[model samples]
Target: SHIIDVIECKTFEDLLATTQPLEEYLANAGCLRPLRRLEDKNLLVDDILMFQVLHRVRGPFERFRDGLRTLGVLDKIKGHPESFRPLLCWSPTMLTADLVDSLFTINLSPVGSNRRHAEEVGTQKLGTILAFATGANTVPPIGFFPQPSIEFLHQEQDTATPSKLPIANTCINCLKLPLHTSYRAFQENMDFALGNTHGFGMVKFLIVSHY
Candidate 1:
C-alpha cells in the first residue's frame, strides 16, 4: 500500500511526505528495509522512484541503483535480497569523463599521415555534438550515450561508393565515419549521424542516432 502510494504520488512534496516513514526507518535501522520489502512483492523501484528517494536520502545511491539496472542485476538482487546491501551504504564515484573515456577505443588509420589530426577533429566534433544534445559542459553523463567501451573506427573511401554516409551502430555504440576522406564530407556525415534535424518538423531532435 505504501509502495502504491509512492507510485501514485503526483508531486515531489507528496512523494516526500509518503516516504517519510521509510526515511525514519532508514535512519533508525541503518538500512532500507521498506525499499527491500519491494523485493518480497516482486515490485521493482525504477529510476523515477529512486530519484525521488535520492532527493531525501542523498549519497552515491543512484550510481549503485543504475549500475545494478544496467548490469541486469535487479532481478537477481530481488531473488537474493540478503546478498545485497542498502543503496545508501554504497559510495561509488559518480560517472566522469575520464571514466567514460577509459571505456572507448578510438582507432585511426595506421598509414595515413593525417590520422592524428583527423582523430582530434573528429573527437572534438563528437563532443561538441553530444554537448549540444545534452546541454552539458563538454562531457555529458554516460547515460546519454548508448553504451560504454564503444569502438570508434575510421571509414575508408571505397571506389564503388565514394559518397557513403557515416554509420552509427547504436546497439554497440560504435561509430564508423569517413575520417580519412575530405573534411567537408566527414563533417557532413558526422552531423548527419549525430546531429542534423532537418525533416522532423516541430519536434526538436537531440541525438539523431538515439531516435
Candidate 2:
C-alpha cells in the first residue's frame, strides 16, 4: 500500500502530472489538510501544485507568470475596488524563497510530544520524502527513527538525511549492501548481527543481487 502510493511519487512533477491532483491524492492518503487553506484562499490545491511544479522546473520569470496564471486572481481584479485590486495584484518578483519553502515544508522540526506524534503518524517517512523532493531541509531530533549501521554506505546516498535518524539512514524501503553481495550472505550476516542485539523490531532487509 505504501509502495503503491507515497513510494511511487519519486518527484514533484511525478505528483503534479498525475491525473489525480496531488492535493486530492494526499488527502486520500490521509493528509486531510494537504495545504493550509485560509478563508481568503484563491488558489486550489491543483493550482498550488502547478505553480510549485512550474516554479521548480521553469526559469524564475516563467515561474512568476505560472504562479499568477495558477492563482487566477489577476484576471478577476480587472475593475475591482482599489482595496480588492491590491489583494490580487501581487508581484511575482516579490516572491521570496522562504514563501516557497513554507509551501512544501510541513512541521519537520517537531519537538518533544510533536516529535513522538510525527513518528506515530509515519510523518518521518512521509515528511522526509516530501521535504527532500521539495528541497526543504530541517534538522530532526536525534534517534527519531532507526537506521542500519552499514560501514560502506555512502554519506550522501540520499540528500534527505541529517533527520537525526541514526547512521546509514537511507530510504525507508532500502537495504544497502556492497556491490556483488549475495542474498544468502547478506541474510546470514544480518541474522548473525541481529542475533546479538537484544530486542529486534521491524527491519527491512534489502539485498541487491547485482552490481
Candidate 3:
C-alpha cells in the first residue's frame, strides 16, 4: 500500500533532517525515480506534508507519559526547545471544546470509511487525524473528528517556582506562556495539563485507530 500520511510530531526541522532515512529507503528500494517522475508530470500519488498531532490511548496515561519522556519530549519542554508540532494526540478522554474546534471542525468526514460505518461513527477521531495529517482540509474548517473516549488527566497542583523563560505546552506546538504571565497561570491550567505528573509527552503518537 502507498504511504497515505506521515504525522511527524518530531518538530518540522527535525523531521526534515531525519527524513534522510526515508529518502535513503526510497532510493535503495528504487521507488524514488518513479515517484519523482510522476511528480514531475503533475501526477501526485502521495501525502503532502501537513503539520499536526495524533494521540492514541492504549493502556493508560502513565504508560503514554513514560513513553514520551523516553522520547525526549519532556526534555524539550523543559529547555529552550524548538517546536515539534504533532498533527494529533490520542487520549482516554476528549479535550476542551475550544481546543477541539481549533484542531478539527465538526463536519469533516473520515478518510476510509464505509457508508454504514461512517453513518455509525460520523467523523471518528482516527479518520479526522488521517485527514488532517494528509492535508485533507479542503474547506474553512480542517481536521476529522474529536473522540474523547478516555479520561483526561486530572490537574495537579505544584508549588509556584518562578521561571525567567516562557513555558510551552508540548501537546499544542505553538502554545507558549506569555512573558508577563505569572506562574499562577500555570497552576490554573498548565500545572494540570503540562505539569510534572501529566507531561505533554504523555500524549504523543500511539498506534490506535478510533472507532
The global C-alpha lDDT for each of the candidates, from Candidate 1 onward, is: 0.52, 0.41, 0.37
Candidate 3 lDDT at 175 equals 31
TM per model?
0.23, 0.16, 0.13
Which residue window of length 10 is worst by lDDT in model 1? 197-206
Judged by lDDT against the true structure, how good is candidate 1?
Answer: 0.52
Q: Give the Cα error of residue 18 in candidate 1, in Å.
A: 95
RMSD of each: 22.3, 22.7, 27.4
TM-score of 3: 0.13
- Model 3 residue 196 CA deviation (Å) reads 64
Best by lDDT: 1
TM-score of decoy 2: 0.16
* CA error at residue 78 for candidate 3, angstroms: 62
Candidate 3 residue spans exceeding 4 A from truth: 1-5, 31-211
lDDT score, residue 144, model 2?
26
Tens-place lDDT per residue, model 1, 78-168, is 8877667665257577899999999898777664468767767656665645433333325544464644233335434654433335444
The lDDT, on a scale of 0 to 1, for candidate 3 is 0.37
lDDT of 3 at 170: 25
Candidate with maximal TM-score: 1
Better of 2 and 3 by TM-score: 2
- Which residues of candidate 2, in runs, are more than 4 Å off? 1-180, 199-211
